[model samples]
Target: MKIIASTLLCLALAAPAHAAAIAQLKQFVSSTKTLSASFSQTVSSKGKQETASGVMELQRPGKLRWAYSKPFEQLIVGDGNTLWIYDKELAQITKRKQAGALGSSPAALLAGSNAIERDYLLREMGKQGDVEWLAASPKKADNTFESIKMGFSNNQLVEMELGDSFGNQTRIRFSDIKKNPALPAANFSFTPPKGVDLVSE
Candidate 1:
């Protein structure tokens, strides 16, 4: 699960750095209860880049599903209590308590409570093309990423870029976003398949 873990942890660590962009983020978070979107992600390091595509769904106060159907298959789910990471190719599943798995990270920004200001420091990055940008870093030390930036258009999250401690960068763009969608509870639940290895932490 190295690939999947690194991909998600790096992206999760990014936060807005600019204060001007907070308005869009605040409004979006305040109004949005559930969201679904198709996303494309790219990770670049030392002149090499890898790309992946996936679909994601999340409901506020903790619940999410990230389904990767690209070069390989992986599924990450948070059922508001436990977090599950399933790698289909390896037939392995990793599970952890949701509180320890997510905390106040970007996952919380999307699906957790609306207390972002307590965990992240937001700064103004002005605009990048058509998207208004915000940059963020955690108040507490996070070795995974040095900084993270988010792009918003018309108060909707459309892009995110993350830079890691090793100078690696990951960018994700969301398309066909549907806000406040009716996501069923089962979408966030997970169960290891028969004979699959399970690691509980």
Candidate 2:
């Protein structure tokens, strides 16, 4: 499973231009409940790049499903209390308690359970092309990612860049975003295939 992080500026720490960007982000999060988007993810590490394309569905209060279709087939689903990761090539399924899994993790941030002000030090990085960028780093020293930046276009989330502590950079660009979509309950449900190994932690 690939997790991504986020950022948003605070008015106190930002100049007038940045403060306006922060306000737009705040409105985006507050007004959005369920979102579905097609994403293309690129991971660059040690001078090599790997790319994957996927569709992601997110519901508030900790529910998400990410399915990768290109390069490999994999599925990651979170159903409020548990996170399930299934690797089709490996024929394995791994489950982890969501509470422990999400602590200071990118999943928490994406699920809207982690407050940006409480967990990250946010700043506006100004505009790039048509997108406005905001960067954030975890306030705690033990975070998995070194920094995360989010890009927005017209107050809509369009891209995210994540730099992990392991020197790997992952960038995800969102397209065909549908905000507050009526996602079915079955979208977040996962059942392991027969004869597959299940590892729970």
Candidate 3:
């Protein structure tokens, strides 16, 4: 759970080669104002792997909800201003400023209002079958991720791989993605559960 939690921020990196890949990525970013998808996530480290499945919803300019239901239950919400992480089994909720939590993370690239080109250097990593790949590295020096690779098929984002300096990798596959969906404001809002410990940062 901690691996997933920590790598959530790493879910955002790239270089250039195929002009088509970059174009497709830019198109997806520019056209996708809101999105919803079912995701399967894998985190790998030192020959071990952990997997989880969940649904995600997000609106551009900073708002997202990630609800995990497999292996355990956890919720991560970014309500424009604040980021909240709720661990159901432990009965604890952790919070921090949204901007501070995201920085140049992949979540920022996906849900943030900022121009992606300004914060990341995009590179084309060629194609893997039908999926065109692009890589990104944060322009910021203090970013947590070492790099990020995204795969797009038919100009739609379908996969993401994130790497960190510690040799850990997280891979996420999105399916049944609905672009420009009308997401409810409630999805992005959070209220700490009664009797749960609240840790604010």
Candidate 4:
């Protein structure tokens, strides 16, 4: 789940050739029924950071599954409009409606029928320290995310940073990405156990 969230930040920070890359990615994701990729993430909370690595499987029209197979095994699945966040260690699952978090969700943007021009007003910015950057703010200012900043190296998305409504930030970097690959349909479906206590948030 964090991988997909991070990946969305990656998409948000489209490269200098972002228009072209997004154009290609749009065609790829829209046309393909399933796509898979490998990802690595670093999440920070209270000045401490934890690193997790995993693979992601996504189906268009709102089906996404993220498997954290390293450090620990965790699963987060979004079946169309419902989201399930499962913690293997605690043996707990948290559920939420997709629309509630759509404003700041990565799956919403990556899987939606939207274009760069429609959602965001693009800006060409100069370098921020050592990294070259491109900043994009949503045209719909009502969204929970304030802006998405994409960092590029040699025209590929090496890093992405996002600013959300609560002033919290999430940054993700991708490596050895395999785009538009085959994925299992089962990756997006969920069959929670009977007594897991489904909390409606």
Candidate 5:
């Protein structure tokens, strides 16, 4: 759970220092009800970098499921209040309160509220290469990440580049996104099965 907790917390926080781009992103997300997308993730920490490809299902107002399929299979689900980490090989289920998952965590930005102006400071950086970019920094500092940059392609969020307090950076790019659909209810909630290990984080 330590690996999942620490590795994921850094990947989720929402902090932006820019505005105009945030508005476009906000409207796109806020207006949409549900989103399902596959992602290419690159996580860097302690000067080391690794990449993983995964699928994500997000429901607005606080629910997300991040399923990783590369290198190894893993699933992390957040049910508004509780966070669950499930491991395939070990058949292990780890649980924790959502508060601890607060490092610019994906949900802090993705599911909670799309209105960046409501909780984050937005900075419009215009464009970077083929993507339009926005910098966002949260109004609170009790979280882990210092800042994050979100990249848009034709008004939709295509990628998120993050910067943490330790100077570690991670970039997650989403593609093949589909919106407004039914996602399994189980994907957002966790019920530890019997006989498997249950660790509290």
Candidate 6:
């Protein structure tokens, strides 16, 4: 689960890119204020495969809610200043400062707090079928993923691939994406449920 969060944060940081691709990414980021999507995630590592399905919601200026519904129930929410991870079966909630949790991570891009041009080297991978692909590598040495590739269809993000140093790959496919949806304030706010042990780090 932690690895999953880290992978997402890594997506927020990207390096430089070609002129047209850069312009497209910039426009996509700027014009998008709120996004909601249903996603299917596949993680392949060491000849094994695991999959999960979830719904995600994101608001600009550092707010997101990720709820996992299949195989298990878990929630990860970031509300600008804090991040909360709640495990339903374990009945535990782990809380961390958002700054320490997201520092230099590409997740900041989703929050509208980080600029892609400043953090990642972006390259146009050209088109694959109906999707236009862009590859981004982090400028920092401490990044977790080896590289990140994003696929956009008609200016809508539909796929992402994250490769780690250990040859593990996580691919996420998005469907039913609603761009600039009117997400309520409560979606990003979380309070630990009763009987749950709250751990702060």
Candidate lDDT (C-alpha), each = 0.75, 0.71, 0.80, 0.61, 0.69, 0.74
What's the lDDT for residue 66 in model 6? 81
Tens-place lDDT digits, model 3, residues 162-195 = 9877888989988877878788889999999799
| Candidate 5 lDDT by residue in tens digits, 8-74 | 4212112243334666666665566677888777877777777777788877767878888875677
Local error of candidate 1 at residue 199 (angstroms):
1.5
Score residue 79 of candidate 1 by CA lDDT: 89
lDDT of candidate 1 over 1-201, digit per residue (tens): 134634342112112443346776776676777888888888888898888888888887688888888878999998889999999999999999988877655676667777778778898788878778888787878535677788886556788888777787888888888877798988989978999999999
Model 2 bad stretches (over 4 Å): 1-19
lDDT by residue (125-201, candidate 2, tens digit) is 88888878888777888877788888877566778888887888888888887878899999988888999999998
Q: How does residue 44 of candidate 4 score in lDDT?
A: 60
Q: Model 6: per-residue lDDT, tens digit, 59-164?
A: 8878888887877888889999999999887888999998778655556656755488787888989887886788888787777667788877655677888887
In order of lDDT, best first, we have: 3, 1, 6, 2, 5, 4
**What does candidate 4 score on TM?**
0.73
- CA RMSD, predictions in order: 4.0, 4.9, 3.5, 4.3, 4.5, 3.9
Worst 10 residues of 6 by lDDT: 9-18
TM-score of 1: 0.89
Q: TM-score, each model?
A: 0.89, 0.87, 0.92, 0.73, 0.83, 0.87
Candidate 6's TM-score: 0.87
- Give the winner by TM-score: 3
Model with the higher TM-score, candidate 3 or 5: 3
Span of 10 residues, lowest total lDDT, candidate 2: 5-14
Off by over 4 Å in 1: 5-20
Q: Which of the numbered candidates is closest to the native, going by highest lDDT? A: 3
